[model samples]
Target: MKSPEHPSAGRADVRIVAASPDAARQVADALRRRFAATEQRSYPVDDSGGTRLHLTVDTTHRPEPAQPWLVSSRSSGDARTQTDEI
Candidate 1:
């Protein structure tokens, strides 16, 4: 969803509309991990299958970077737990 410029600095309202509930949730989850997000509200688009999720995120805030090993593990599709690395 394109965010029109907000009057306030470092904060934007975002709306995530997806064809399915799962798809909307995945986008919301990823956004939450990356930004300081408010509680999400979900709404049904119509009688058909579609979802709309609304939330505000603080653009100025950023989540910590993933650890090197964890990042590499994901890229390689290795399911080893952190303890398994020991």
Candidate 2:
């Protein structure tokens, strides 16, 4: 598939899936330090029972990787929407 024009394009490709805020922060921090990235962002999910985080890097010298994370394009049971049976 063609790469996204933006990271959160089709669907947010969450790199860090943490159970708690602290855990998410640690993961984000680790990624930032390791990659020397500028920033990391996190989004909470109400229906998915977890939190998601992403780390982005901008570089013209090196081409970005294709789909670094395998995030689903479909919402499915994600917090954006849920089943009617609930």
Candidate 3:
């Protein structure tokens, strides 16, 4: 699949699914430290039973390269969305 062309293009995108917002934040922090550059966003769902966090990272300095690394590093159970250009 093609990678998104956002500023974070060649970077790695991380998504965390947690039981609570706090958990998601905690995971995001951990991921942020691991990755040099990171972007974070949150979403609200009617079903508050649990919280989910999605993070996208730009591993490469290039505007848009390949996303093989992302596909490989991504969690087996997590849902992913790849866009073509921001």
Candidate 4:
């Protein structure tokens, strides 16, 4: 069977910051499920507090993969930023 076209296809490089590593993994897993062709990586914060997670997903495609949703913690103190490249 053929797959459905993604809403945000043709975009690449999705970056997100979460409250914890688990949260980041959860969000990445969710995105991977949503986009069958997504490649995800997570970086957990290693410090005294241990309350931050950074994640990056690279979706491979000819033109590019769709733009994935970013997951950021509400208590992160800074607003999240998103950028797109074509």
Candidate 5:
């Protein structure tokens, strides 16, 4: 017997299986945010109450973070002294 071939380096075949289609789609959407991904395809699991979503992502390119929390503050004062009125 021969072994199956894998995807090329920096490319991946991602599968999101969940109890509901919404759950699977959410996971696929998250992956799309982090990598260059193809449109997701959906399939119903055989005899199971679950949905399967498949997509291909290129790991070599990752998009910028949705929220840049690591950026340093430019303020001259200490962070503890900063005040914000809500």
Candidate 6:
């Protein structure tokens, strides 16, 4: 696996459209360590739609692989994870 860089360097790209608090926090912690940056923000329940987090992080400095963190096809967007685990 590759090492994470600081957000200031823009090394990764991550987004969480809807995830449970526990999952989100776990992912967030992993992300913080992986990307070496604090979270962007926490959403309020009203805006979150539920007890899920809707967060986005931009780390575009890293090299692009065969697949990326997100994929878009005109009317929709999807995520196809490249790693076996976060």
Best by TM-score: 5
Q: How far is candidate 4 from the true structure (C-alpha RMSD, Å)?
A: 17.4
Can you list the residue pairs that collide in candidate 5? Answer: none
Which should have the higher lDDT, number 2 or number 4? 2
Instruction: Give the lDDT of residue 20 in candidate 6.
Output: 53
lDDT of 4: 0.53
What's the true lDDT of residue 52 in model 3?
Answer: 63
- Residues 1-86, candidate 2, lDDT per residue (tens digit)? 99756554222333788887678888776554434354677788677667787766433233333453456354466565346656
Candidate 5 C-alpha lDDT tens digits along 1-86: 99867889999998888999999988988888989888899999877879998899999999766656545544556556436733
| Pairs in clash, predicted candidate 3 | 4-83, 5-85, 11-57, 11-58, 11-59, 12-57, 13-56, 13-57, 14-55
Over 1-86, each residue of candidate 6 has an lDDT whose tens digit, in order, gives 98865444544455554445566677776665434443555554555554444344555432233344455334344566658857
Residue pairs clashing in model 2 are none
Using lDDT as the measure, name the better of candidate 1 and candidate 3: 1
- Which whole-number lDDT from 0 to 100 does residue 13 have in model 5? 93
Q: What is the lDDT of residue 71 in candidate 5?
A: 56
Error of 5 at 21 (Å): 0.6
Q: How high is the CA lDDT of each candidate model? A: 0.87, 0.60, 0.66, 0.53, 0.85, 0.51
lDDT of 4 by residue, 1-86 (tens): 99854445554455667767677667766766554435555555566333443333335433235454554323566555646633
- TM agreement with the true structure for every prediction: 0.63, 0.44, 0.49, 0.38, 0.65, 0.35
- Which pairs clash in model 4? 8-66, 9-66, 11-65
Error at 2, model 1, angstroms: 18
Q: Write the per-residue lDDT of candidate 3 for residues 1-86, one digit (tens) a residue.
A: 99855544566656677888888898887655555545667775458667766777656543333468878687877555657634
Query: At residue 8, what lDDT does model 4 achieve?
Result: 52
* Whole-model lDDT, model 3: 0.66
